[model samples]
Target: MSVKEVPEEYLSGYAEILAEVGRTGRRLTRDEVEGRRALGEQAAESGHGLRALVIRHLAATRVAWPRTTSPESVLAAVEQAIDAFAGGYERAQRLAVRKEEAARREFIDDLLYGRSDPGRLAQRAERFGLRLAHAHAVAVAAGPEPYDDTHPVTRSVEAALLSRFGDRRILLTTKDGRLICVVPADQEEVVRYFAKQAHAATDGGRAAIGRPHPGAGGVVRSYEEALNALDLADRIGLDDPVLHAADLLVFPVLARDREAMADLVDSALGPLQQARGGAQPLLDTLHAYFDAGCVAAQAARTLRLSVRALTYRLERIHRLTGSDPTDPQHRYMLQTAAIGARLLDWPAKEL
Candidate 1:
């Protein structure tokens, strides 16, 4: 190979080693092997191709071998040197990879948690293909089991996402045992696709996408929204595999005033404690009733009760609470209270 293809100095001392081994028939010393290995590591870290380095080392060995030397001993020395060199090269590459991963993880944590200065974070984000100035939306998925970057399910979702998007501005990672994807707000489909892939991979687990928000802090806001959506889904017993925070915004508003919500829950539903079955069955009945859109027949079907039985329960609720669930005006109060109860995990949670 020409000196231009492989650096001339790369072969400088290598040939000397081969010539010495050929002349004396003595095995290369530990220092000699270590020196070549260190050279390999330096070459790798400097972006030199391994293929070129190997070819150059082999060719130098050929030209440096003495005319009368025993081929067996020289060949053994060549094998040992090349093996040591390659081992060093590989070690250097692995170390670089680990460092890169660590940097990327730190950047992600800072970006999502708003721990870094906005200007500095925006500059750092560019290295990872994120433009923090643009609006971004975050989607989070939570499964029955906690997940990490190396999990098979996490890898599968990542592969699926890359296959579709070709590693664009979208970012995927795992945080607090959940999978998260952040994408530019304009690319709504990316976050949706992430949610779909995550839900399928997580085995009936739920995914939530937060509405798009702008700037560095917006990402944190969006991430928190997605997380809250997932939590709210669990508290309310929502069955949908995918949820959007936009649709459920009201729950947060109602829950913001904890004292008022607690009062509402007690005033609207507390009287059910006087019933024979206590509040749970009636609470469930109201849940079914509201979920069924005030359709008695549908609610009865959901509760596995006949319409007459369901009506009697509603009547009993009216008598205890003095609010008829079937009344349009009373329905809103009762429904809101039921939601508040679930959000506060009342009764069972002593809210």
Candidate 2:
């Protein structure tokens, strides 16, 4: 639509996009509004990496405008940008493609580097020749070791989750598929709502989710809390959508998150605390063993026992706690739980 024919809102939207392009060291011409939309329309049509580039362009424009830019200037800019981008595919490629990659790469770089962005982003999707119509984020529910590693089941689970990103605009990749997500902001609400139900249907591994944030930068933020959600899932065996970043910032009462969990383990095994009287031998030994980094010899020494005697005690512990000392995974879990329990108030029901 001509700048004049375009509704003031839409024309302003085009301007907003241009202003964004300008803020990114990319020029925003009055012609780009029409250019970006036409390209957005094209990306919508290309339906792959091309579409991702299109969204990146739109996102960049949105970022530049900042919701405060006058609608007229924004519209005027959008019209100019669209005029250029819509005119041919080359400008869109040179502008949107590289910018998208830059945005994506910048995003991945921040993730790899442990940095947070103010919601601005860059992309690198064209290198893979993948087209993304839209973008959405996902969080994985992961437990300790085996479940945290790479597995075919995890890959399949991600694939399943990707299918549910509304228009199928997700690109699934994870470090270990353990406590991770794609983090596409576009489908945050839907992804948050359906991820649990969807993941429950998947095979292998357990996971939880945090709400998707606004942009590629927000995606990183979302993934940050995904780690916490994952820890909760591992500790509590939570099977429902029990957490979200969108709500978390307001409360930020995460310190108590694990408190409830610690309480759970305490409740489940609290009675044992009194069995050993003034000193709960099992718990004391468990603490020592864990503090000694699970080294049996060190633990035995700490417990002032012969190695064989420590073995016998551990065997009793196995029978009493059902937590296998020989199993590294379970051993660590119980150890962590025990340490967590120390922070809780163990009620005295009279020894």
Q: Which candidate is the best by lDDT?
A: 1
lDDT of 2 by residue, 1-351 (tens): 222222233224554455464455344643544545565446434433443444544555665664533566555555556545445445445677677756665555565344654332233433332222233454755533443224664555565665655344454444543534464455565455445643554433455555644444455555666666656544433344445544434223423676575565564456455455632676677777776787889999978988888787677677666677668867756765564555442333221
Per-model C-alpha RMSD? 1.7, 18.1
Model 1, 1-351: lDDT tens digits are 343587766555777777777788888899988887888888889888888888888877767877644878788888988888888899999999999999999999999999999999999999988999999999999998999999998999999999999978988899999999989999998988999999999998899999899999999999999999998998888988999999999999999999999999999999998999789999999999999999999999999999999999999999999999999989999999999999998778876
**Residue 322 local lDDT, model 2:** 65
RMSD of 2: 18.1
Per TM-score, the best of the predicted structures is 1
lDDT for 2 in candidate 1 is 43
All candidates: TM-score: 0.95, 0.35
Q: Stretches of candidate 1 above 4 Å error?
A: 1-4
